[model samples]
Target: MDIDARTLRTFREVTLTGSFTQAARRLGYSQSSVTAQMRALERQVGEPVFERLPNGVRLTHSGIVLRDYARQILTLVGEMETALRRPAANPPRLTVGIVPALAYGQQLARVTHIGRRLLSGVQLALRIMGTAEVHDAFKAGAIDGALVLTVVDADDPADLLGEQQYADRSDDLTEVRLQEVEFVPVTGVGRRPGGHGRQVVIADPDCPSQRWLPEFLRLRCDSPPEIHELGSMAGVRAATQSGLGCAMLPTALAADHEEAGGLRPLPGVPRMRWNASLILGRHDTRPAVDRQNLTETLRQATALGRAARPAVPAAEVLGGAGLGGEVLGGGATALDPDTSIAS
Candidate 1:
């Protein structure tokens, strides 16, 4: 019997979710379609894979055995694909997706350096997107890799690119530390207090920082403040600096404003720290040689970026900077030194 990859994938998803409806939701298929796929799979296997119950579904004995083999088969197929797709003579092009905030920092420089030195002839394509969008694009084969801040809870270890740590724990997602970020609250310079009330601008509502913002506010302030949600950090910062509201700005990016006395953190509001990660699709088809070079380039760049900047105070780092008013680096300022030093 000829078994297809799609059938295996469908079986795996159904097994994982234990409900065709849930599996279909995840796979972007209809319930009927998923059911049909499973039925076809069972026909091929000559046994029932799932037993339908009023509560949900359960895998039959054969289903369990097939699942284990299916996983192994898929993994082996992926490895084979990776091995086969390695470039021979010409260099391979690697497309990398990045969130706007990550694209602006040391990541850009590091990726560029990797392309120049290690990747040599390889072309780099950078796509700016949110973490969710990046993940979708990666899974859909739209991009080869990404640098994103994703929750660790549901992420498969095999899908992750490297080491992980807890950045923040929330109801839906556990923010993992990809890279240390310094966040500062900022408002326009010379703006009179109470002109527009206290406005808090956030990036996307789904952004990890934004997700944590309300909780942060609840802990810090008793009263509910007006909140503005923007699509991008740039938008939030711009709105805040226009005297529309106050925003949590990356320490590195907010340096100029801070130096010019345009932005300042609210009194008793602590510096926020978050983690960033380099994420890549498991199916990235770059040659092994190219993958090694690119990975090394990013690793070195991240290390250098981390080393060059002073560690933000643990309190100021994320949960709170501290009551002492110590300055921590996060935004464009942190990267400026690296650029100048490199030049």
Candidate 2:
């Protein structure tokens, strides 16, 4: 079917908001007009796109299928527009995939540094996705590079495909250790003393913490504590602040919430360390000058992360294989003194 850009845009809006009325308000169209547009698009595609349920309007299976293609088409269109407007002297674009957990202050600082210095005229697209999705995207050539946490053993074959690190490894990629933040269990401020009864909220099962937390809890607690699986750190913090339960969160996040009187760390819980890393494919053919400039920008960004309180260890921030056999490179040089913080 030949769906126009306008129709696809409407469909996307409705899909995101899950309400035709809300989408209409955002799009500045009458509800009737929005409904008519969706109906017309459905007719063109010869299928029912949405099904109204008690909670909200949901995409039908057909709608779900079309949405993927629509996103790709829109992305291509955006790329075309950018290419047409870009200056001839500008460097080629660098597409970087990052995990959703890394989309915060320190990460923003790095992106800003890159934008101002190394990536001056170059387009730097930061795509937020899950760690697994980031790895898949890198392998599929959907992104030129990424910044994500490493979970699999350093010696695993997948780990060696990019650059390699103990905590955050990849094979043929340039690796930079960002920061080693620790997670701690936290609860609402001024709450009761019976901390044992408190529910423990966790991020989705896919998160590294979730995979490790069960084992830690099993060993530490007398019995299984109530568990709530949330999609984001914000949600977990919110739940804990409302006295819903205890949450294991990054020290940085817990500190922010504690300052706001929303939460406090549960005393006696051991902190667990996690690291972030930057990964770029070796086969990527971007210009040498551009790569050098980008690398410098990343270093500055990571340095900012290190400067934050609770100084992280440089050794903990690695770029080679772990006990497993993931080799970073045959003769890759260590990070320079100017860029890397001393372990």
Candidate 3:
């Protein structure tokens, strides 16, 4: 069957998003155009690639096979482009998206430095976005990659983006476990006196910490915490520091501020764990060895101190052979960065 690169990319986006409308939006195509492309592809292949459902579509057996081949072909195309490109005075750039939480603290500089070191001459562009927005940007081919959160529980069924078990390592895609952080509720020094208000400081709706923190409060308190939506991580931190409301934050960050008398942990609240991973698409134009080196550099950058309990390795976490595996449970988007600077 005759196939094309653009059509393959459309198919991959549809598979990733599980919706025609979303794929159309990502690819900047009209819904009718996306429909026509799929129809023509189906007619040529003489098989239904997608099992249509009311909510979304699922890949048929044939579609899964096709997806594998498409990935390989597109990966080769990316390699060829990298190999044949002429060198210029200005380096080719890759724009990577991260949530506000990741951009705070020292992570922005750390990642920026690491990206430059690992990729050498390539320019690294960092943009701040909500976690879901980051994923949407990736699907739209607007960004090279993103730092995303997945539940640590491998048995959970909702984590679709969780890495999958693979005997052979992928030359194209590279996933690196950066750090695992604990989410805890924090309140300003004045607010700690009573801790009685329903007001809860939160980031934008897309933030995972916002969702998780409220649920925790609902379970333990007689009344649900009032939602105070701050659009950015810095806003959340500032508001919480001023006693506007208690906010959920990383344990490390909370400790740093509590020591400085700016913020203190909320009484009678438990912390939850979240893992951060750098997700690179298999069809990304970067070289395989460079991707590998980037992953290693990230791993080293995020290494925890000896006094802290060791985070689960990526291999054991995903039930995969090594370095990569699909997350298989409910999706949590991003974690707040708690480092010295946050204090």
Best TM-score goes to which candidate? Answer: 3
How well is each residue in 1-343 modelled by candidate 3, as lDDT tens digits?
8998778878876886688998886566998998888888888779999999998899999999998898678656554555566877898677777766555565666676656555555677877777657545766788777665555543332342342322133343344445665566678887746553467777655555566666544543435667888766678878999988887775655666788998876654434556666767756766544554455445444443111523332223223322112332223212222211111
lDDT of each: 0.59, 0.60, 0.61
Off by over 4 Å in 1: 1-91, 105-110, 150-178, 194-197, 222-224, 283-285, 300-343
Can you tell me which runs of candidate 2 are displaced by over 4 Å? Answer: 1-86, 89-91, 151-174, 190-192, 196-198, 222-227, 306-343
Q: Name the candidate, 2 or 3, with the larger lDDT value.
A: 3
For residue 287, model 1's alpha carbon misses the true position, in angstroms, by: 2.2
Superposed on all Cα atoms, model 3 deviates from the true structure by an RMSD in Å of 14.4
* Model 3: per-residue Cα lDDT at residue 217: 49
**Candidate 3 deviant stretches above 4 angstroms:** 1-87, 155-176, 304-343
